[model samples]
Target: MLKMAKKHNMCFALIKLSQTHKQQLPAWLHCGALLRTYHKLKDACLKQIHEVKSIKDLLKVSNRPTTVPHHWESHDCICGLCVSDRLAGCKNPHKCISTVAVIINNLTPKFNPFYCPINDGLTLTHCRLEKNTRARTQHRGDIIFDPSVSETLQLAECFRIFAGDTRTAQAPAHRLQRPNQGQGQQEPPIEIYTDSSCINNGKNNAQCGSGIWFGENNPLNKAIRITGKTQSNQAGEVAAILIGL
Candidate 1:
């Protein structure tokens, strides 16, 4: 069955070619001649080759058709679907569309010339052919997300949320070491450092408040407030730490 189908396809293709080039073909080469050749080839295959259950097995016993030439691979060329070997040396190559169209129309009985496969396989009943052609020609790249705007905004919002959660209370005493008074107990002099800055210092958009406790027992027993120009609340917090240090 597979062998028969392949033979039938080849015969149909040859018939299509012969009918298309009837006027240009030699007197001896015609449909009758092709039909006789086809029968001889078909008979030889049946007698010499064993029957195959599938197309793949049939291909093992048959010679495959040659590939379409490079020039005829693309749809934009003058050949427009016709094989290169069929159109060689034609004077009015531009006028080959009529011959090509006839062959295609016969070979692919299921194809609808008025429809576009990309348009959901629908028949192009009312579409403008010129516009569709231009659109297809101009298509370039696939659509993708634009990361510049949305990504930047999301990052900024996240930073703002994090900055709002800074500790507002005074520094814990556990952070500092205890003072020593083995001899006559005299209290160590308290040295307080203070500075202030804003997150967006120059812009005055957001402000950050920070204090440190610094002493002998307390690492930062002396409290300091840092307030001034800053880019972010984090920067203001950093400034307060520096002042305490």
Candidate 2:
């Protein structure tokens, strides 16, 4: 009983001191065993933190579908997503809403696109294409992503509901809506075949490169450099296709 009480007090003390100016780290830092435990949980915490961050990244992308006629005139329907329900269900409503707002407002053309498999369609680049064209990249899942304009307002809703801010909270339900085929016409996609290869497999230093093959006699053929940290055969192959795209 005494040992349990001591442990409880130690945790409470750590919490209180963690917020201090940080001239000194919490004493727990000195405990290698404790750090090992923290390392074990690091992946789970990173996963959750990344999911929340993805909501913020969504704001940096454009919501307009470039292929749609008069895309500039069309209002993003994703913006209509209601957050009142999410707020009502949140235990820390104020923090959640505020964090979400910040994340959702970051959409822009300069943003780098990424995928979060755990997130809804509102955050996916595939969903940002013309409604009918979304199918072309549907199977790519979170692997292939690019910044786009389409259903951006919905991103705000997603951020508002998912951001925990400084507190821990469960996010409400959300999902990417199916592309609603609008009357607008779509631009044709350019087609090409991409491939990659690497030499010297698990050796001291390997050479890897990506390549794009357009057609039997097409002149747009070339090899791409993908050498940095990834000297593996698969990384080279994947890099080739991504570069081609």
Whole-model Cα lDDT per candidate? Answer: 0.34, 0.39
Off by over 4 Å in 1: 1-204, 215-223
Error of 2 at 159 (Å): 27
- The candidate that wins on TM-score is 2
Model 2 agreement with the true structure over 1-245: per-residue lDDT tens digits: 43653444322111111111121222112211112323323223222432323322222222323332332322222222213323333223233333433333332211212221244434444445544354465754334353322223322232232223234221222344547646775656888888777789767688888889887777788778785776888988788777777
* Candidate 1 lDDT by residue in tens digits, 1-245: 43644444422122011111322332221212323322343333222333323322222222212232333323344433233323443333223323233322332211212122222222233344455565668884433322221111221222222222123211111212347726787776866654444554556567556666554577555443444554565665676667665
* Top lDDT model: 2
TM-score of each candidate structure, all chains considered together? 0.15, 0.25
Clashes of each: 26, 16
For model 2, the stretches where C-alpha displacement exceeds 4 angstroms are 1-182, 216-220
Judge candidate 1 against the unseen true structure and give its global Cα lDDT, from 0 to 1.
Answer: 0.34
> What is the model-wide C-alpha lDDT for candidate 2?
0.39
